[model samples]
Target: MGAGMGMASDQQWLQLALTGLMVALLPLSYAWVKGRRDRYRQLVWLTLFLTFDLILFGGFTRLTDSGLGCPDWPGCYGTANPFLAHANIHAAEALMPSGPVTWAKAWIEMIHRYLAMMVGVLIIALMGLAWFKRRELRQSPWPATALFILVCVQGAFGAWTVTLKLQPVIVTLHLLLGLTLLGSLAWLAARSQPAASHDAAANRLSPWIALGIVLLAVQIALGGWVSTNYAVLACTDFPLCNGQLIPTMDFRHGFTLWRALGKTASGALLSHDALVAIHWTHRVFAVVVIAYLSWLGLRARRSLTLTRPALILLALIALQFASGLSNILLQWPLPIAVAHNGGAAALLVTLVFMLTRSGPDTNQKV
Candidate 1:
């Protein structure tokens, strides 16, 4: 709700970029020195790793109620970091001690931004390297190029996440885009390596994997919806919601995507039934996801190349179930909630990695 772009000075933006560049140098240096061949691929995988971290940290920022810690995009109180904006943060906190802005929360939010920018810089490097090495590189440069654009769009959504006052739709889309970027990077990383031996079974399972991805994407969206709306505790019990199999729910209001956070489109306060609807839908749909993905993982295990990732997928499914339960049973512990988010990303990465290798060798070329 703060005047996002109008509040931040140009100097703050420059400083933010500088900090990101500094953070990116660590991975750049590592890739440069550690890689003897296919450094591009090395950087891609590195970017993927950091991106996974960024997503988890983003979840942390949200879970801790730090989304509005700085209240404006790309800077804290028109400054690059929390230290420079301490007076403002302190004033806001002092005025409302339980409110969104606090020194610690500001740092958490700003640090999340800094990591995001670092990932952006690395992706820029990837786009540049891919284009520069297009002739000799094993994989196509276009996907890397597309990744750069995707990161920019993700950054936009990141800004909107704050500026739009953490609207559920915007936040959910932001989460989805982050996962999409992770999955794309996973595929690119897989392509940068030598093609594995073709598994007819894995190839045959491609359509099923595609179906699983659709279901997984839907489940993740539902999860994001629940998280953004803070509806996880709407159903504290495992098998029942509000001690009933079918609790009263306001599906119309709950599924209204464009409304403000905790409010309906008409600006009335969101109802308990709406929250229950959000949480319950996610809970019920999760069963379909678990069953389908479990079957997919088991089916994938029959493939020689996909067996390991398939096992990892099954493990992640179990982790999701456990962490998800912990969120409800433990009243949404920070570590468990964040791990639940990270587990989703890991599942997507593993699944996409499997999909990348599932194709025929002829189509495997970058």
Candidate 2:
């Protein structure tokens, strides 16, 4: 069996850790040199920037069908990298030329892991600095500590994404956790550099902002479900699906959470109707999300303190709408699909950043 069919050994885990540490060095060095006033804050922002990139690259990995490129967790076929696992990868590729395992895909998958591990290492450094410099930093270490725990949980789901054979639920959760990590990091970065503002008018919108976050999260989850299940092309037509307003759908089977990929709860091959259901649900729910977010953006744009972020929010929402339509009309082109995912992340970060600045109880000073 190639690396895809075998399990990662103990030694391989050590090699992966070392590889992650090596990848982390550059970013760590940058934060150290540039962080004169607040190294912790610099690292936090750097980590956030890299985390966003990781999420985009992750989108590439998935869209390219490279999730199973290694077919094993933490390492490529029980080796540290694709180069070391050539024999196994070659064997698998030879067996099935067009299968999930291939040289290019193996590289893509391993690179994703490498980037994820790099992010993990940065988070660890962040938590360490948070604890050691809490007094000087004037920030709670607990948030960093919580971020640390969340990343571990995310790593676990990532392993499951591979080990469980790209099961839809596991993969979707992995995507969601990654975005959640990004949003959390944005919150930290905002806290690190506070903008002194107490706009009661803007602050009044905090509750609605909170609601927007919740709605966006649900939309993201729905989108993740569509992507993980490979249902993006189920209804290729844009405003209407399959040239019909309400096509036949298998909602129960489509939304069955615990089933394996491309299969129903009882292991039957998933029907086209089920895929339609998944895709259609995401498409319909998007109207509500888009409308609500656009309204929120317009509402927030009136406030001087929030105008910039509000503009960013509206711009990203437009990008999302355009990219999302292109995904369907363009037949799920890789670049547009990836941009759609990134747009969602950007929107979340924008909303969270705004929320952090505007607290509901704060009164306007100006």
The residue pairs in collision within model 2 are 3-77
Expressed as tens digits, the lDDT of each residue in 254-348 for candidate 2 is: 99999999999999999999999999999999999999999999999988778999999999999999999999899999999999999999999
- What's the true lDDT of residue 343 in model 2? 94
Which ten residues in a row are the worst by lDDT in model 1?
A: 1-10
TM-score of each: 0.96, 0.96
Candidate 1 to truth, TM? 0.96
Instruction: Flag regions of model 1 displaced more than 4 Å.
Output: 1-8
Taking all chains together, the TM-score of candidate 2 against the true structure is 0.96
Best by TM-score: 1
